[model samples]
Target: MRYPENWVNTKPGLDQVVKKLSSLTSLEFKLTDALIGDALILFEHKFRNIGDILINAFTIVTKRDILSICLRELLNPERTFNHYDLFEFVINVIDKPEEKILFQLEEYAIENPMMDVFQDNNGLIPQACTILKYPSIMYEYMLVKFGTKSRVTRYLMKEIITAHIGKAKLIKFYPSLASSVLMDFRWQELDYIFNTYCMAGVPFEPEFLPLVKTCPSDTVIKCLFDGYLSRLFGFKVEFTLSRVDQLPIFNIIPFTHREHNASSEANKEKVEWLNAINCNQYEPITDTFRRHLEKFRSRLRLNLI
Candidate 1:
């Protein structure tokens, strides 16, 4: 996609754009840096009718260099300012009065899928999650501009969940708010959200347990339970029967063979045949439930084998 024609032809347009970018203070610098980088990369590749002025500006706005400036200026401990202001500034640059620049940045993010434009030194995923706390337009901007099903989305979801769990007090104060934010995203992504946030060695917050319990899908419920179980076990374990050999074996029998063997064997054969005929017509649901429980138990690293 081409840069807007008006942006290309304006007098000293590139300089004007750079000046506009440099004028960004605090968190706004992050957004400006991202946009500037996109512009620079496009100009460098000679993608469109970019002028010499713009080309020079692109050179000055190298990705690493801009990030360094951000770390030094806004994120530095010596700055004595609420660094959140930087977040606000970044949000404004994207959603500010000028629609042209915002559109250009959006287009750039789409065109350059491989560019780590929104990330920090560690990565864009974590940084974006941190910025999401600011309640800025950039949160939505980043989510929508980047394909939400992409690996980046999974990474971002993980980081966002991590950050949220790190600040448990916020979740406690506004449980509905947290839930609403999570609900805004597609449900298919819930597995990554749960695995990334809850299974990442963070302490389980009692308040968050309900969210997992209320999930509509058995798949997600399984994942949530797995995460909880992992935390409980202090390590990961595949709770499948085939993997039971890895766990401690327990040989406690609930009943003696003489007590129930004849009745149990007859009932088991009848139930198996019934299951084979009408898979959904089970009564009391005890057999089906017991079977699944046994399967789950077999997968657990418990004293039952």
Candidate 2:
């Protein structure tokens, strides 16, 4: 709060101004000219000189223009910058953040001799890859920066594989990536991985036996059974037979059935196939599916309408 006699003529006291601005709520920090003027003055004075203080201000301020200004200033190549928090803050706040900023952060991380940032699980580049939509250039750059055989590259690939898995959901599969990650790491969400591969038409493999043994949710079991059938028959097929306990196969037996000539034969064959496969090693649910089907068929025969 101390003002020199010729404070106006000397370096402007903008640090306190920025500090106060940082504490104000988004709603309170209206983009009025007075505020922008003060921010611009702060930008000019404190940007290169005060690193820690301005970085803190950048973290708290949410306004795009101020953030933009701070980010531009931080990216100055010659500046001895090492604030990962500030780097992450800018990228997270801005939509589709500049690749250059991420590059700069990576450079700083690499230059630090004490810590192997790339190898560190807590490194920001992997997280940054998620935000930047995993550009191939960035991925390749990282691979070369940290040799492919290195633990760091494996970690980066893990991030890439995880991102692909999340995006795959049920319909898509990244075969190479899936194999690479699954063969090495034991993911906690085996059910999700199983369901994704099953629904994506990946044939049953012995490796999946452990997942089947885990006895995942009934819906996942249905996916497993359906996948096995598809692999066996060389054609994609879904069991739309009946719902039992909300499971696709059989749950509550429908009271009456309206018979259709075309689908009756197909349905019968599916049921027959389902029964035949009940004892197969690949069929993890034993006779649960067949038992439900039989129960439903019996209910239909009784004409309980």
Q: Each prediction's Cα lDDT score?
A: 0.35, 0.39
Q: Report the Cα RMSD per candidate.
A: 21.2, 20.2
Instruction: Write one digit per residue (lDDT tens) for candidate 2, span 125-211.
Output: 222221213223333333333333333343333343333223222112233443444323333233333333333333333333333
* TM-score of every prediction relative to native: 0.25, 0.21
TM-score of 2: 0.21
Residue pairs in collision within model 2:
243-251, 244-250, 244-251, 245-251
Q: Per-residue lDDT for 1-305 in model 1, tens only? A: 24555654554566675665456533355555445434433443332244345434544544344423332233221223321323223223332312332343343332223122221112222222322322222223333333233233334444344343322322333344444454444222332333433343233333233232222234333433344444343335443211111211222221111233646644564344334324433322333334543444455536334
Q: Give the worst 10-residue stretch by lDDT in candidate 1.
A: 241-250
